[model samples]
Target: MDPVRNPYSPGAGRQPAALVGRDAPRSSWRVALERIERGRSSQPFVLYGLRGVGKTVLLSNFRRAAAERGWITAQVEAGAGKSLRESLGETLHAPLADLARPSAGRRLLIALRTALSFKASYDANGIWNFGLEAASAPGGGADTGVLETDLRKLVHDLAAAAEEEGVGLAILIDEAQDLAEEELVAICAIAHAAAQDEWRVLFAFAGLPSLPRVLAEAKSYAERFLYERIEELHGDAASEALTDPAASENVRWEPSAVKLIVEESAGYPYFLQQFGQDTWNAALEAAITYDDARVGAAAGRATLDNGFFRARWDRATPSEKNYLRAMADDGDAGSSSGTIAARLGRKPASFGPLRANLIAKGLVYAPEHGIVAFTVPGMAGFIARQPSTD
Candidate 1:
């Protein structure tokens, strides 16, 4: 087997060779696009899940699908050292530029002017030239220095322009749980308005499992948004995810080998791909066998431990690592805040900053009131394997 022919991809947000078990969400997004193209509104999609569950991959798929349909699509990630206003302004520029022309529709011209204002709102020294007389267009009030007011004006005008072109607008945000509270509230408000007014725009957000709760807290209307919880593949879907890619390379996996990798990876897409790649490299024959799977799984685990899990583990301070160690006793199911504090011989109130810091670093999340869990799967086991210094 040639390592160069390996079809598996294992990295953050990397698209898999065979994306399986996501038909429901993908179909729903297609329907949403069609509905918007037909002057109908669709509920925003909120995808929440643990890290490495393929939320980013699915969101990227939605972006590609919308772009294929000629929609005005801008996909951005929050918490990347840029404000929402700045990130959205920068991402929307290229698409908006593509739509600019001398014979552009009146509404499109207006949208271009509005976009200029939005860009100016964040970057006073920078500007965009759409090669049209947009300065004289009838739209340009989006630079009001208010998030809700400015974003609403920009999106509304853009949606109108999209409708004029017989398409739609799409705005997708990943790592949404990292957005500022005010920014999240503003987005929810604008999305609510778009739905009520039947604007030709669609929104999708992806983040940690706490994303839905975060949205609800931002705006009550977010309660009605369509929330899809992405999890590991199961049953036959999981098997197909591993087999389909290998089949494409004209390789076969013995039933015992497939079962070994599937069970060991626990159906996680990232883990499956890692093990699949390793197994492909380990197999000397055209058919992967159980022995090869054992070696590959071990190699894959070592790779994850050194790179994936260790990276996050090293980001924690010693005090935070102690806190994480206390939580590891509960495995991946999460730990009670009170119990973690009791284990650390400290009051729960005193450990609030530690818990908050972990959450801020994206290593953990509060799944429910007073219960925090690792945002990454199998984190507890990784933590447990570390040498103890306390």
Candidate 2:
């Protein structure tokens, strides 16, 4: 087996060789795109899950699918210290530029002018030359210094331009939970109006498990948004995620070996790819064996410890580490805020800042009212393996 030809990819937001166990969401997305193309409105899709559960990967897939259909697509991530306006403005430039021409439609010219105004909203010193005369066009009020007013105008004009081109507009946001309150409200408001007015635009958001609650808190109408909770693959889907990639490389996995890796990885997509890669490297024969799987699982766990889990663990302060250590007692199911405080021999209110810090660092998230869990899977075991800092 050659490591150079390895088909498994195990990085943050990396698309795997074989993307399994996501047919439902993919099919829904296709239908939504078709509906928008037919002048029918569709609800926004909200994908919420733990880290490494493939939310970003799936969102990327959605962007690709829309782009393939000639939809005006912009995919962005929040919480990178940039506002939604800035991120969206930057990402939309390339596609819009590709669509710009001298004979562009009236609506397209208007959209270009609106986009220029949106760009100016964030970067006063910067400008976009779409190589078209959009100055005399009708639309340019998106630089009002108000998030809702500006975003609505931009999306409306762009959606109209998309419809004129016989396509649709798609806007996707990853890490939606990190978006500012005003940003979230503006997005939800525009999406709601889009649906009511039958605008040819589609929206998708992906983030941690708390994303649904965050959206609902931002706008009560978000309750009606289509929410898909991504989780680990199960049974046959999990097996296929590993086997299909190996098969494509003309390699085979013994049933026992596949079962061992699948069970050990707990059907998580990231863990499966990691274990699969290690097993491929460990296999000396054309076919993977159970013994190779054992060695690979060990290697994969070490890699995750030194890389995935350890990176997040090291980001915590000593106080935050103690708080995490206390939460580990509850395993990956999450821990009560009061319980963690009690374990640390402090009042719940006193530990509020610690919990908030962990959440802000994306290491932990509140799944419910008072229960907080790791954003990454298997984090409890990783924390338990760490040497005591106290």
lDDT of 1 by residue, 50-99 (tens): 99989999999999999999999999999999999999999999999999
Global lDDT of each model?
A: 0.95, 0.95
Q: lDDT per residue, candidate 2, 1-390, as tens digits?
A: 689988899999999999999999999999999999999999999999999989999999999999999999999999998999999999999999999999999999999999999999999999899997889989999999999999999999999999999999999999999999999999999999999999999999999999999999999999999999999999999999989999988899999999999999999999998999999899998799999999999999999999999899889998898889999999999999999888888899998788889999999999988899999999999999888953
- TM per candidate: 0.99, 0.99
Error of 2 at 262 (Å): 0.7
Any residue pairs clashing in model 2, and if so which?
none
Clashing pairs in 1: none
How far off is model 2, as Cα RMSD?
A: 0.8
Off by over 4 Å in 1: none
